[model samples]
Target: MENSLEFAQQLDRTDPLQSFRKRFYIPERNGKPLIYFCGNSLGLQPQTARLALDQELVIWQQHGVEGWFEGENPWLSIHQRCKKPLAQIAGANPSEVCPMNNLTVNLHLLLTSFYQPTPNRSRILTIGGDFPSDQYALESHIRNRGLNPDETLLEVFPRPNEHTWRTEDILTAIEQHQNSLALVLMSGLHYYTGQVFDMAAIAQKAHEIGVPVGFDLAHAVGNVPLKLHDWGVDFAFWCSYKYLNSGPGGVSGVFIHEKHHGSNLPRLAGWWGYDEARRFEMTKGFVPMPGADGWQLSTPPVLAMAVHEAALAITAEAGMEELRRKSELLTGFLADGLQETATVEIITPPNTAERGCQLSLRIKTGGKTVFNHLTGQGIIGDWREPDCIRLAPVPLYNTFEEVWRVGQAFADFTS
Candidate 1:
């Protein structure tokens, strides 16, 4: 636990998951791998991703349209390859998970089905500062449903100057709005602050008030431990490009609790979601396939699915419990080291359970210069607007040494 290079090297040498770092292609500067602490924005490319895409290309060239039903991993069932891994990652039954669509697309589609408001309870309650897309989707969807955004969209903000929301404050807000609330939509993890919301508690309180609850797990999915099914979450969606290590714009994953599978809940349907047994019939009515797959709105994207499937396989192998264990140690190590640097203000919560691997630092003076200094040293992290540097030490590919070097970079910086 010492803030020393020797200790950091010792931790890396003993990490059981040490070899997993070699599984991805790290970006380079001056022929050396950069300390890439940006998994929150996008993960490094998995070594297997290219080969997976090539296999699909070969199938496309060799079998043409027949590839849908032919080949070892047929295009028709391409989505199935990702199911088992996604299920393991999301803590859901395979039938309840589907890796499809972009994150925002799934958010809108899920909202279309889940955001049914009645006159007595017409409002949607959400965190005040969720990701911009989620904010837009809720506002526009409310308006499209003929509800006034100003009246029907309720938001809960942090108390006064606080950077993160308190669990009690969130629970109180839910109870205050319960009588008028129809749905609770929130991000499992706050993207900007790197705070992990108390999802289980939030879901419980929402349901107790007879409201449906859903989470946008863009930052929480692979970065934290999630038991979506057991937690009684009604629905959720996430992008795979971040912690899942899929290439940019990779297929996103969706989760619908098994309890909703048989219900006649309205969904935006397409031929892909048609009952698998009778898909070719192209019947007049849209009979959705059982479980989360029923929400699909378009045909499978095989090329994207290939890379996604490959990336998820590696995650499944590494396992969330192991990844999270390493993540806590990795993130804590850096946080501890920063205590020696007096000028940096950490906005992310200090509790281990309340955050993943990300540390959102607010530099007191010349923040941008400090960021530039780190970047010049080949220690690459991202700079967020206003004034904050978001650094995520991904356990899958990032080493403890990298985390230590970042601390050293901060220690040596003058600005």
Candidate 2:
């Protein structure tokens, strides 16, 4: 307690955005603040979220039917209004983006539009350790096409002595399977290991081989700078709960490069994707909106959109370049501190450019013991299945002092 209090004092002295901490609801036990380091999972709620949501609630109560058209935030163009700032974060044009369903659902929708398997080339390639949701989506998509996953789905893995696959190895896998690849799908940043993959290089190589490339940016969207359209990625999807600081199960987004916007692509049709000009004409068939907005399947969730809009405004306000600057400094500070702890090894790559706000620490000894110790002491970081602890110092809300404190907590646990 003494050490934690002293660390808190030090943090208070040096934190640049420390005032931002008060903008969130901090979980507590017995009237003390519990240290939160799980922004990589679900970010703390923003203070503005409630106000944004309530603004709509008031409209709903005062003018039930009119609110849909005349509300302060009109339900009609609500989704459209969110695109510009989100596009800024995604490195895309407004027309190339849309906020729709959850991450997995959006991935499935994108596959329907982009993953058209031909007789000779019907396989989808993914990384070996992709998130389970993505794995299942890929397997199901292949099976639905009357293709066997065992034969059609290829997985690229790390070499014999490595815990993480190198960029070169992944590119080699793409080359080896190029002849039969219908699509090359990958996570922009790995979930478990916290390694940011080289999206530009991977996309370029896959395109060279005549295979379309897509990505699940659930961990990368707000954590790193992306040049999605410039990289020539066919499509991408991301959830907003993590680094973007929208609440749990908040809205997710998708991107479709402009090149495919006018193509005669087949997509799962829904009323939401119908052209807005004639949407209320009681049309019998779907008329798709151009660009990524064509993928929408249902009415937009206004409350969720409000929460995301608030967060996106904050992200655009802070600017990715600035957030990334703080992120590199804060994560590197944690990495440096862990090295001196003498009982932990960082599994994630050491290069700041190769990662985001997270550091995956493998405790050589007292793994769970250290995890539990931190928990008991009111320091909260997440632990993966067996031995790794994931610490994310979100640039918007986390401070360098917190990084040092978490480090000392590890030292105390090791001792």
Candidate 3:
């Protein structure tokens, strides 16, 4: 693809999803809209979000205590309503998915049930440089079980000098450690370098040795095509605030394979997860609702779920198949535009299959200066510490021309 405004505009004109750009509020500078390439961090606010949230507020104002049962969309079963779209996004059956607490909280809860250390098999196999919350949660859980973190957590690092991991290295780690591994939990997609791990391969290797496997899909859910159920992932979790565009601190959820729904796998139970038919009975014993709904720790936040429902509907309407097709083209065009810039190094994997919307650039010199200049020119991308700038041209609202302008902004940077 040529790096020219005419070419970029032509691509936008022919894009089937071009009209979708009007559905969200694009951030602006001065009077015009800025180039927004930060959807991997937080998505743009959907126009429907305001109306959805206001509906819940009105329910609260009118019915107060009875809102859970009274409104057109009752709060009592709001979590259930989200199941279908969430399942579609997660690539799991509705029975296996449920929206609940935030990411870290769900991480802790899932680890409690999944990380069962024994005398012979008592270690966890994971990747180095996963999201910090996953690292801390694993460490705390290891310590809680009277084991040392350094001994129980085996992290597979990148080979020698590489930004992204090799699938073979990870597979070997799991195979070598399988004898002593009780759980294998890792990020489906790397946060910093924008690498998509070979999750299907990783899960297959772990399960071959009878080890329980899971993934932190915080970056993978809406950004890529996932078949968590077909791939036999034991469990997975993610946040909706990013590509899902539910809003900041939006509700999080989990996918528990249906096989475990009937089994007595341990879980940290709460009142909200109680068996629905007998919930109001207020019985003493905790009988969990069947399937992934059993993982809920508290009442689902209606306001947050309302916004989530509206945003998720848009994703459902577009469908992941179509979204992924456009995403690859957009990122490929961005990659080609910057391939010749002397000061920039593309650290993210070049293969379309190994990445989604994000492309992390390690600027060789004056990285922050370059980032600031881009900002001044109405190019909005985020700066990671020391030397990287992240630009994610989200397929939902971002356009071909905006990505083209970013390349122009770089060429015009004096440094």
Candidate 4:
């Protein structure tokens, strides 16, 4: 635990998941692997991803149009193959998980079903400074329902000079707007601050007020432990490219609680959502498939799903609990190391339970220049606007020595 290279190397030697690092293709600069600390943005590609993609390519070349039903992994039911693994990752029933469209697209689709606004209870409650795509999707969806965003969108901001929201304040806001709150949309982990929200408690509080709750787990999924079904979350969606390690622009996954799956909840349905039994019959009425598959709008992208399959397989083998334990240690090491430096502030929560792997650093001055220096040294991390740099020590592929190197980079830059 000492702030020394030997200590860091010792920790890496004893890490249970150290072998996982070999599964990913780490990007290099000048013939050496960069100290990658940006898995929260986009994950490093899995070494098996190419093989997975190639399998599908071979299927396409051999079978062509018949590939839908005549292949080792048929295109028709490829999405279903991902359900069990995705469910394990998100802590939901296989029936409740569906691998489908992109994150924003899935949000719009899920909103169509869950974001129902009555005359009196039409406002949507969410946190401020959410991912821009989420904000855009929520605002546009509200406007689509003939509602004014300013009046219908209720955003909770952290107190002045604060970096994260307090759970008490979030619950208080929910109580105050219970009557007018139509939906409670929040992130499982804040992308910028790296603060984890009490999603289960938040969902319970919202449900007590008769408000439907959902979460965007873009930053949480694969990085943190989640129990969507146990939490009674009405719905949730996340992209696969981050901690999930699917390739860039990977297909996203959705979780619809079992309670809503059988309901006549309104959704923007498509042929893919139709009952598989009657799909070939070309039925007149749209009979939705059971569970989350009922929410899917189109045919699955086999290549993308193949990549997800490869990535999810890795997660399934490693297990979330094991990965999370390593994540806590890795981030904790980074936090402790950063605390020794004077020029930067670690804004992420000190408690391991309140964060994933990301640590958001606020540089006192020359933030971008310092970031550039880190990059030049092959220490890769993401720079957020204003003056913050985000670094994620991903448990699956990142190591303790890498965290030490980053701490050293910061000290060198500041000194």
1-104: candidate 1 lDDT, tens digit per residue: 89888999999999989999899999997799999999999999999988998998998899999999996778989899899999999998999999999999
Local distance difference test scores for all models: 0.92, 0.87, 0.91, 0.93
Locate the minimum summed-lDDT window of 10 residues in model 3.
Answer: 406-415
Per-prediction CA RMSD (Å): 0.9, 2.5, 0.9, 0.8
Question: Which stretches in model 2 have alpha-carbon errors above 4 Å?
Answer: 1-19
Better of 1 and 3 by lDDT: 1
Q: Report the lDDT tens digits of candidate 3 across residue range 10-127.
A: 9999998888889999988778998989998999999999999898898899899799999677899898889999899889999999999999999999998889999999999999
TM-score of 1: 0.99
Give every collision pair in model 4.
none
- Taking the tens digit of each residue's C-alpha lDDT, what string does model 4 give over 1-415? 6888999999999999999999998999779998899999999999999999999999889889899999667899899889889999999999999999999999999999999899999999999989999999999999998999999999999989988899999999999989899999989999999999999999999999998999999999999999999999999999999999998899999999999977998889899999998898886889999999998888888899999999999998999999999999999898888887887998998989999989999998889999999999998899999999999999999999999988898888777
- CA-RMSD of model 3: 0.9
Q: Give me the displacement of residue 358 in model 3, in angstroms.
A: 0.3
Instruction: Please say which candidate is ahead in TM-score: 2 or 4.
Output: 4
> TM-scores of all models?
0.99, 0.95, 0.99, 0.99
